[model samples]
Target: MGLDFVTVLFDSPFAVMNTIGLIAFALVGSAKAIREEFDLFGITVVGLAMAFAGGATRDLLVNRVPLVLQSPVEVSLGLLGVGLAVALSVVLRSPENHPITLVADAIGLAAFTTAGAIVATEATVSVFGVVVIGTINAVGGGAFADILLDRSPFILFDDFYASCAVLGGSAYWIMGSVGATGSTAAGVCAAVTVVARLVAVTYSWNLPTVQTLGVLSERMDDQ
Candidate 1:
């Protein structure tokens, strides 16, 4: 049998954005695994899951093939990301104290949300659709990780998670409506999301939930 192999680099603007998000997520996932006292193998798994899950989910939702699965370069980069996370975790040995994980998560959320907005624009989706896609792209990986860890999803329980994504997507949609596209639109989108997320984290801002929700949740707990 004969086989042909070719490289699939994350060379385009969209691909590059997605790759950036992937690496950022890997860092966050690695830190989280370390905080959980996981071994290297567990770290690798969590890192890859956090890295690729969001983008894969976004692609699947858009009816496109997942980039990591189809791209050798992306897969290699993903592995490199995992390896880097492992090295960093071992070196730091105190992941909980470092804020880099939250920073990475914010960056990843912004990048993925912006990329999804761009994809939605190219697909001629509605503004609401763009927000939905972007939000999903931003939080899908983190949500998956939380589910695996048996925790409440970040977007559902924490600081302005999906709101940042929605705002980012709305910015892009408005820019496109005003005849803006390309890097400028992407920059505005990502900036809004990242700034919002970082500020929310810094200030400990959270969405308003029923006070009884927490009480109910605690009461439902096995403990």
Candidate 2:
């Protein structure tokens, strides 16, 4: 990826927005987890881990250095989010207020999905690669957050999160293919992801899981 400073600066505004969103999401998740079981230090670890875990892994997969390493702003926003989470833990005494968590996750997913597409476009990546990176960036944090909380992946159970991210990233790649500018593409992608995720959640749209009995019947039919 031959990204210059100018492009990384101007063409990647979505990256900044997405990075901030991730920080907030990580913090909320971490704070909730801390309030449930962990202490202050553990909260910090979970917050940082969830905040940067996915994008860091994505960068390594794409053979690029992590953005948080190069930008102090990323650290600042992430830490601020974590701090807010810790503070919130002091008052909100119940997990029943999960709406806050949902909102944070949605914002973070939108930002990361857009950022992933932007980065893929800058790298002149294929459509599939763009979608892959975008989806990963969008849901990576949630996956890590759930694991830290000792829960199964959220994407597998609810919210249609990964599908929305993949669709949004696909939209970004399509728009870029038509020669759209970076900022415009990012905005479009973010909007699509946010809308899709909200609609899916609102309507409880999700795929049905297949059980083992159904699988055995299909296999017998094939035989």
Candidate 3:
């Protein structure tokens, strides 16, 4: 069974996307830690947390052992990302906010979103479940990292982020509903997520709050 799983892992689109997400999110997390002047141990912890938290949560939801607990490769990939962030910090003044980091975050978001959608589909979950799981998988890690950094989870108040994952998951479900192959659906999902996230970053797009929409002011006037 282990051999068969290994073979499938090598051949699976899920594996590829998972690898990208692990590395990219680890780098982003490590970069943020470095910017915060965290010690090496703290940086490593944050990086691994960002890489594994979401996947672990997803696995728990599906009643499976977390892959990070079973695979040394997963930890190794996360460490590699941390090393890359450290190296970048040696050269770049602010690696956390660098364009490379921004792009990596977008790619990571897309990869994890697609991976989550694929896993949720395999679990025979409802379409709503797929979107919920996908969005959580994409943003859960970053939220965890933020908490470690002593900040509120940026997903709650940050610019358009989790919505990209929602859009990607919706696309994945729609494509599958239309009889698309799993690979095709996964590709479309990742593409949609990455593009949406990148555009949001580029344009500084943000979802409006109730205050921004004047709902509070209107209610006050009515009272």
Please give the CA lDDT of all the candidate structures: 0.80, 0.76, 0.92
Q: For residues 1-223, write the lDDT of model 3, one tens digit per residue.
A: 8787666555787997898999999999999999999999999999889988999999888889998999888888899999999999999999999999999999999999999999999998888999998988899999999999998999877668999999999999999999999999999999999999999998988887877679878988899
User: Which candidate has the highest TM-score of all?
Assistant: 3
Candidate 2, residue 200: Cα displacement in angstroms equals 2.3
Separate clash counts for every candidate: 0, 0, 0
| Model 1 lDDT, full chain set | 0.80
lDDT tens readout by residue for model 1, 1-223: 1122221234465766777887888778767777887778887788888878877887887889987788776666667767766777767767645686678788999999988888877877777988888888888888887776667886777759888999999998888789885788888999999999999989988766787688878888947
Deviating ranges (above 4 Å) for candidate 1: 1-11, 212-223
lDDT over C-alpha atoms for residue 97 of model 3: 94
**Per lDDT, what order, best first?**
3, 1, 2
Against the true structure, candidate 2 has what lDDT? 0.76
